[model samples]
Target: MPVSPTYRPEPRFFDLGGEYGDPVRAADFPETRLRFRNDRAAATVGLETLTDAEWIAHFGRFVPLPGQPGPVAMRYHGHQFRHYNPDLGDGRGFLAGQLRDDEGRLLDLGTKGSGTTPWSRTADGRLTLKGGVREVLAAEMLEAQGVPTSRAFSLIETGEALQRGDEPSPTRSAVLVRLSHSHIRFGTFQRAAYFGRPDMVEALVEHSRSLYHPDLAEGDVPGFMRAVVEASARLTARWVAAGFVHGVLNTDNLNVTGESFDYGPWRFLPYYEPGFTAAYFDQTGLYAFARQPEAVFWALTQLGGALKLIADAEALTEALNGFGPAYIRELRAAFLSRLGVKSLGEAADQRLLDTTLALLREGGEAMRWEPLFHDWFGGFASSARALSGPRATLYQSKVFADFRFSLFDHEPDRPERLEAAPFARPEPEEMVIDEVETIWAAIDGGDDWTPFHEKIARLRAMGAARNPTESP
Candidate 1:
C-alpha cells in the first residue's frame, strides 16, 4: 500500500486492556464492491494516496493498517429506548484502528456490519445496503448543514442476503467505515459502574479527558463532565437548527466527542412539526424532533450517574444543571449562524429566535424548513432577492411580518454568500425522505449509481458554496 507521509497511526484504545474490548475478525463475504469512498476524510488521516485496490484490501478485507491494531469489538452497556440493556455492546462492528489527523486530533476508524461479536446474541451482525446508503446521506447532509457529525469514510457492498423485519426480507448487505473523534460512548462508563468497577470508571474518565478533552486537568472528572455537557448541548442545538431528527438517542449512540453517528431512522424535517419522528417504531415520540434536547440531556444524566461512582454527587449534579442554559446559549448561536446573521446581543437574539420559531409554527405545512433559511440566508440584506423569489407570497403574509421585522434588525454575517451559485437556485439542497427514496430506488431496481453519485456531488457542491473556505 502507498502510504502518505503524514500517516500517523496510534492504537490508543488497545492500551485500555482486554476488559474494554475483544479482538475480532471481519466476515468473509462472497463479494467486495466499493459503493462510496470519502477521499476528503481520507486526506485528513493521510490515506488519500492509496489506489482503489489497496483501499479495498485494507478497508474491505480488514487488513490491519501499518502500525495499527486489528479490529476490537468494544464492550459497553446502554439504555435502549429508556430501558437499561446490559447486553448491548459492539455487536456488529469494531474499532478497527486509530490515527491522528493533519491537525493532530485523534480519530477512530470504526466499522459497522463488519461481522458478529460475542454480543451478537442471536442475530446476524450485518447491515442492509439500504441502511448503509441512508447513513452516508445522513452524515453528508448533516456535515454540510454545519452539524458536528461522523463522516462516512468508506462503504463496501458485501455479497450476502440478510433478512430484516424493518424492511423486506433478503436485503443486500454492506460494511461501513465511519471516521469519528472517539468511539468511547456514555455507555462505556455505565458499563464500568454497573459492574461495580470504580477503578474502571476512573480509568475511562481519565482516558476520555486526556484524549478528547485535553484541556481538562488530570483526573478532573467534574470539568470533564461539564465539557461533555457543553459539547452535547452544542451538538443538540446544531441538530435543531439543521432540523435533523436523530431517531435513536441511546446512551451507546451518544459519544464523548458529541459527534452524531449511527444513523438508523434519521430524517430531515419538511417543516416545523414538533411531533415528527423518523422511526416508525417510535410510537411514543420519545425522541421526536422537538424532544431531542431533552433526550440528549437525559443521556448526559445517565453518563453523570455512571461517573458518580468516582466523582462527587454534588459536582456531577452541578454539571448536569448546566445543560438547560448551555443548550439555550448554543441554540441562539446555532440559529444565528444558520440564518447567516450577526447577533444583536443576547436579548435581541432571543427575540429573533422566538419570532423565527413562531413564524415557522404558524406557517405550518406550507413552509418548508430549509428554504426559509436558504432564502433569507443574509437576513435583511437578501430581502430584495427573497421578496421576488418563489416563496415570496408566503413571506409577505401577515404571519411572517414579525419575523421579517426582527430579521431586519440584524446585520448579515456573510452577505456575499447570497451571491453564490447555490443561492441562485430556486431551492436549496435538501435530503427529504422522498428524494432519499428516489435515489435509493435507482440503485435497488437496476443498480444504476448515477443518481446516488450525482446527489453526493450536488451535496458537496452546496456545502462548498455555503462554506467557501472549507475543503470538501
Candidate 2:
C-alpha cells in the first residue's frame, strides 16, 4: 500500500474539555485482523503512508494518533423512540480524532466497538461482526445512490467471540471506523438543554457552527438552524427517492450535520410500497418507508427546539416551518436526478413526478422500485427493451401517457452512462435484506470477504453512473 509522505493531524474536539466528553482508552483486544481499509478516505487524512503494523497500532491497538494524546468518549443525551433518555451517551465508541481533508474541512474518525466507557453501563462495549459488515454495506449503497453519508473508513476484526440473541451465540467481533463530516448529533444539543444548561447549549452550538457551518456569523444560531434544517430536509428527501428506509430515526441516531451514519436495521425497498418497514421490532411502522419524511421533520423540529435556547425563537420557528417546502422541492429534484432527467421547469417537473408516482401506485402491487426509474432512466428516450417483468405493462397503459409526454420535453441527465456495458445486464446492484444476509453468511461461514468487497466495487460503478464527479 502506498503511504503519504507527510502526516497531518488536527486534534481540536478536546479543546471543548470535560463538559462535552471524557478521555478514554480503547479496549485491548487479543488480536487485530484488518478486514477492510478505505484507502480513498485514508489518503484524505494523510494516513495512506501507514504500514499495516502502524495502521493496526494506531487504529487497531487504539493507540492515540501521534499528535493526539487519547480518544475522547463524547457525552450526549437524546430521545430514543420519542422518549428522552438522559443516560444515553457513547458507551462503546469514541471520537478518535479529527484531521483536515484535501478540501480543508475537518473530518472526524469515530470508532464503534472500541471498548466500554462510563456510558457502557451493564453492556459489553463490543460490536458484532455482522453489525459492522451491515454498516459498511449500508453506507456504500447509500453513497452509490448519491445520498450524503459517512464513509465506512475501516473494519478491524478483533480476536474475540461474543454472544448475542440477534444471531448465533459466540459470533465474531469487529471494530468499525467511520469518517464523517461531524459527529455532532441532534442529541448533542439536546443533552445541553436536558440539564437546563442554556450556557452549555450555546457553547456546543458555537463550537459546532465554527467547525462545519463557519459561513454563518458568530452567535447566528438562526442562520445555523436554517442551514441544518435545509440539509436535513434534502437528506431525508434523498433517502425517500433512493427507497432507503432508515429503521430508526431517533433524535440520537440523527446527526445534526444531516449526514446519515450509524446504520442499524436499514433496508432499501424492493418495491414502491410505502408500508415497507425495515426493523422487525418496529411494531407500529413508526419509521416505515412512507413515514420517513415525517420522522425526519419531527427530528429536525426537536433539533430546532434545542437550538432555540440560543437562537432567536421567531427565527427558529420560521426555519423549522421551512422544512416542508424544502423537503418537497428537494424530493422532486432528487427523484428527477435518480430518473436521469433534467428538470424542464417546476410545473412540468412536478407534473411528470406526480404522474410517475401515480403510475407506480396504479401499476399494481407487483411494481418493483428500482425498475421504474431504471427502465425509463433517461426518460422517454429509453427503449421499451429497457423494462422487463410487471412494470413493463404499466408504461403501455393510459396512466403513463402524461408521464411519457412530459418526459420528452426534458433533457436526460448524463444519459451516456446508460450506454455503459453494465446496462446490458438484466439488473443493477441492489441491497435488499436477502442479499445483505447472504453476504454476511459467507463471512460468518468461512471469513470470505470477497462478496463484501465485490459488492462495494459494483456499488462504486453504479455511483459513477449516477454522479460522475466526486463530492467533498
Candidate 3:
C-alpha cells in the first residue's frame, strides 16, 4: 500500500511525563496482519508521519524500558448502567507512552487489545478487528460532524483467538491505538468518589482544569464547576444536533475534557425520534435522544459530587444549578442550525417548529427525521420543495397545514435543489452493521482507498463550511 507523503498530527494536552508502571503483555494471535493506518489520524496528534517501525513500536507489543518506572497502574471506579462499580481501571489495557507532537501538545499513546491488566477481572483485554474498524469509522464521521472525539490511529489484527459476546466465535484479535485530547473520564472522578477519596478527586479536577479548562483554574471552585457545566451542556447539544445516540453514556464513558469518546453500540437516528436508542441493552431508554440533556445534567451532578472535595459545598450547589440554563440555550441553538435557519427569534418560527415536531410524533414519522426538518426549512422560508419518492407527499401534507405554507407558494424548484443537497442524507446501503465489515475488508486488502478518502475530505470540508469555529 502506498503511504501518504507528508502528515502531521496536532498536539494534545496529556503530555506530562513518561511514567512507567505495570507493562501488560499483549495476547498472542495467529492472524497477525499489518494494514495502512489512518494517516490523517496519525497527523492529527502531532505525529509527523509513521514508518512501519514507528507504528509497530507503538502498537504491536509492549516493551519495558530499563530504568523507566514500571507501568503506573491507575485505579478508578464508576457507575455502569447506573450501577456503581468501584473496581475498574486499565484492567485489560495500559498506557504505552506519552508523546509530544510538533505543536508541543501531549498525547496519550495507549494500547487496547494488549493483554489484561490487574483490572482485567477474568476477561481478555484484547479488542477484535471489527470493533477497531467500527471505532475508526465512527470517530471519523463524528469528528467530521463537529463532535469532539478520539481518533483511531492504527489497527493491527494480532491474529490471536478471542471470545466475545457480540461476534460469531472466538476470533483473531486486533490492537487499536487512538489519539485524543484526554482519556481521563468522568468515571475517573466517580472512582475517587466511590472510595471517599476527596483529595484524589480534587487532584483530578485540578488536573483537568489545567488540561482542558484552564480558564476556570483560578476561579472559585464553584465558579470553575459552572464553566465545566456549560462546556458539557454545549457538547451534549452538539451530539443531539448530529442525530447521534451514544448508546453507552456510562459515567466511565464521559470524558472530563467534555470530548465524546469510547464508542460502542452508537447509532445515528434514521429519523427524528426523541426517544431513539442505539443500544440493544438499553432496556429503559435512559440515554435516548430526547433525554440526553437530562442525562448530561445528571452526569454533571455526579461531577459536582466529586468536585465538592475541592470546592465549598454551597459553591458546588450553585454551580450545579447553572446546568439547566446553559443546556437550554445550547439546545435551542443546535435545533436552529439543524433547520438551516440563520436565526429563530420569531414567535411564528417557534410555533412552526413545535407544530412540526408534534405532528411528526402524532403521525409516528420518526423515520422521516431529515425530511421533517427539510419540510420546516422549505415551508417557513419559502424555499424549494424538491422532495422526491413517497416522502414528498409526507412533506406536502404536513407543510401545507398552515396558510403560511400555501401549495402554490411552495417553490417546486427548491425540492429539486434539496434533492441534490446531501446534508442529512442517510444512504441505506451504509446503514447496516455488516457494511462496516466490508469497509474493513477493502482497507485490509489494500484496494482503492481513493473513494473513501475523497468522501472523508469532502465531509471535512463541508463541516468546515458549516461551522468555521469548530475544531478539525
Candidate 4:
C-alpha cells in the first residue's frame, strides 16, 4: 500500500459522550496477522500513517487513538424476528474510533469480535477467521454494486482457536474493523422508548440529524422519518434488484443511515426465486428475497412508533405510509440501473421492467438472476452474441416476447461500453452459497487467496460496467 500525505485522525463520535454507551476494553489476543486492509477506505480517513504492525495493534489491541476517549459498546434494544428483545445490544462489537473523510462525511470505525461487553451473555465473543473473510467479500461486493454499505476496513487473524457449532469445531479466530457512515440503529431509538425516556430519544434524533440530515428541520421526527424512509427504500430496492437476501432484518441490524452492514447468512440468488432465503433457520421465509421490501417497511413502522414520544403520530404515520410508493419507484429505478437501459419515461420503463421480471419469474427455478440482466443487459442488440450461447433456448421461449417489444422504446445505456469485451463472457459473476464455500475451501485447504482475490477483481469489473453514470 502506498502511503499518502493526508494521514490524519479525527475521533468525533466520542464527543457524543457516555449516553450512547459504556466504555469497554479490547481482548488481548496471542498474535495478530494482517489479512485485509482497504486502501481506498483507509486513504479516505487518512489512516495510512500506521504501519501494518501498528494497524493490527490499534485494531487488535483496542488502544485509544491520540486524544480519543475510551471505546464504548453502544446501548440499544431491537426486535429479533418480530419479537421485542430488550437484552440486545452490541455483544461482540463496539465503536472504536471515528474520523472525517475527504468527502466531509463522519465515518465510524467499529470492531467485530474484538471482545465481549456487558451484553455478551453466555456466548463467547470471538469471530471465526472464515467469518471475517466472508464479511470482507460481502462488503466489497455490495459497495461495488452501489449499495450504501459499511466496508470491512481491516481484518486480522488472532492466534486462537474457538469452538462453534455452526461450522467445524476449533475455527480460527479474528477481529474485523468496519468503516461506515453511522452506527445509530433504529433500535437505538427503540431503547429510549423501552425505558420511557422520550428526552433521550429526542436527543439522539437531534444528534444524528445534525450529522447526517443537517438540512432537515430540527427535532422534527416526521421529517427525520421521511429522510430515513427514502434512504431505506433505496437500500431495500438495491438488495432486491441485486438478488440479495439479507437473512436477518432484525430491528437492531437496520441502521438509521439505511446502509447495509453486519453480513451473516447473506446470499445472492442463484435463481430468481422470490422464496429463496439465505439463512437456513429462516424456514418461515420471514426475510426471503421477495419479502425484503415488506420487512423494511415494517421496520420503518417500528421506528415511527419509537418516535411517537416527540413527533405527531398522524404525521409520522403519513411519512411511514410513503414507503410503499417510494419502494416501488426505487425498485423500478434499481432494476433499470441493473439492466443498463435508459429509461423511456415511467410508463414505457415500467412496461420494460415488468416484462423483464415476468420473464425471470416464468423462467422459475431454471432462470438465474445475474445472467438475465447479464445476457440481455442492454436488450436484444447488446446480447445478440450472448443469446447465441448455451442458454439461447431459454430466451427463445414465448415468455420473453413482451420484454422483446419493450426494447424498441429505448436505447442501451453506454452501448459503447457494452460493445467492449468484458460483458461478452459466457457467465455473469455470481455470489451464491456454493461459490462462497469454494472460496473458503481454498483458504482452509491450501492457505491460498488466489481465488478470493480474483473474485474481488471480477466483481469490481462487473460493478464498473453495471453501475450507471447517468442519474435516474
lDDT of each: 0.92, 0.84, 0.62, 0.84
**Best candidate, TM-score:** 1
Cα deviation of 385, candidate 2, in Å: 4.4
- Model 1, span 18-49: residue lDDT tens: 99999999999888999999999899899999
Residues 325-424 of candidate 2: C-alpha lDDT, one tens digit per residue: 9998998898898888998888988888788888777776566677777777777667554546345666677777867877778788887877765455
Off by over 4 Å in 1: none
Error of 2 at 392 (Å): 3.4
Candidate 2 total steric clashes: 3
Off by more than 4 A, model 3: 1-32, 62-73, 99-107, 344-356, 359-367, 370-382, 385-390, 399-472
Q: What residue pairs clash in candidate 1, if any at all?
A: none
State TM-scores per candidate.
Answer: 0.99, 0.95, 0.78, 0.95
C-alpha lDDT of candidate 3 relative to the true structure: 0.62
Q: lDDT tens string, model 3, 107-131?
A: 6555567777778898877787667
Question: By the lDDT metric, which is better: model 3 or model 4?
Answer: 4
Count of backbone collisions within predicted model 4: 0
Q: Which is better, 1 or 2, measured by lDDT?
A: 1
- lDDT-sorted candidate list, best first: 1, 2, 4, 3
